[model samples]
Target: MEEKQMDLVSLLLRPELPNVQKELPTARYRVKRLSELLDTDVVFTLKGLPYGKVQKLRESMSDDVSVQILLQGCVEPNLKDPVLKEHYGGATPAETVKAMLLPGEIEDLSRAVERLCGYRKLTIEEVKNA
Candidate 1:
């Protein structure tokens, strides 16, 4: 019989305050990629000799992309819809994201990017510094 050594401890998992002194300066802005949004099921015409059809199709398509939008704390309810109609012209949010959407106001770019990326937001101070 082999004896097993166990090292067990209990901990109260809680959020910790960041130590500003040890952390990076406030000028740094966290960046994220554009693909973090909706998941897509891309269909590609792969070239293979299975049943030996003609050459595979050269196009790729994906119509099954799932999206979950959380407008709260993001969009200003009072903001006129005409603003959206101006640039996007009723295009789907996914399309707007693919197009690297920017807000009408320069000051709102961070909020716009945050909504678009759905993960992080930039700061105006950091933007100006950069």
Candidate 2:
């Protein structure tokens, strides 16, 4: 039994395991509607939200949760860029996202952010098995 426990600990300590301190996972999403509007392809790179930030966002219960997520998680095109913000009438990143995307689009992007942040439902049985 002691040997088995040591083996388990050794397996957990393997160097190949991911280091949470490293870069967060990222994904690219193409905004088809935006592309049509701009007459060119527009791809947005998004990074996963940290668990602590997601928890805070959920706890806040703000009306613009989706906008907040996009503001923080959207990496490509730099929503906070001064030039882009100026082009969008000097709007903040949140305002720019609201002006650029419809409500449905905002929700869709928020869902993607949630997935990246590991927000899927899991069964207790699965946890126990793992």
Candidate 3:
């Protein structure tokens, strides 16, 4: 018997491809798990991170500010959301990578992960300033 080796994109799009549509959160979890198994960091732009920090700005300056700074700094440089009329975004590094993976675009998964990690580093810089 022979074993088969599958690419990440194929694995993710196995059940569906042309009509592939997954819930954002579910996709995030899948990406996170894959990254962990592969010993890689999954990054996301800050816009993807949910908002609600202004209220906590005074009570938890460090945490709230850190989140804000991270969000502002890590947003995707060119990607935009047609529905939102804004750049595509996610709440965490994982979400960012997940968002990039449309059903048919799984082939770009590795590159997307790399870009996200790079963005994460930039976001860290923003945290320092905040």
Q: Number of the top candidate by TM-score? A: 2
Q: Return the TM-score for each candidate structure.
A: 0.21, 0.80, 0.19
Ranked by lDDT, the better of candidates 1 and 2 is 2
lDDT of 2 by residue, 21-116 (tens): 376778989888999999998898888887788889878856889888878788887888887777777457778777778899888787877777
Residue runs of model 1 more than 4 Å from their true location after superposition: 1-9, 12-82, 101-130
RMSD (CA, angstroms), candidate 3: 20.0
lDDT tens readout by residue for model 3, 83-115: 332333665543443464553333233333333
The residue ranges of model 2 lying beyond 4 angstroms of the native Cα positions read: 1-6, 121-130
Report how far residue 9 has shifted in candidate 1, in Å: 4.2
Evaluate model 2: give its TM-score.
0.80
- Evaluated against the true structure, the overall lDDT of model 1 is 0.28
Q: Which ten residues in a row have the lowest lDDT in candidate 2?
A: 121-130
In TM-score terms, candidate 1 sits at 0.21
Q: Considering lDDT, which of the candidate structures 1 and 3 is the better prediction for this target?
A: 3
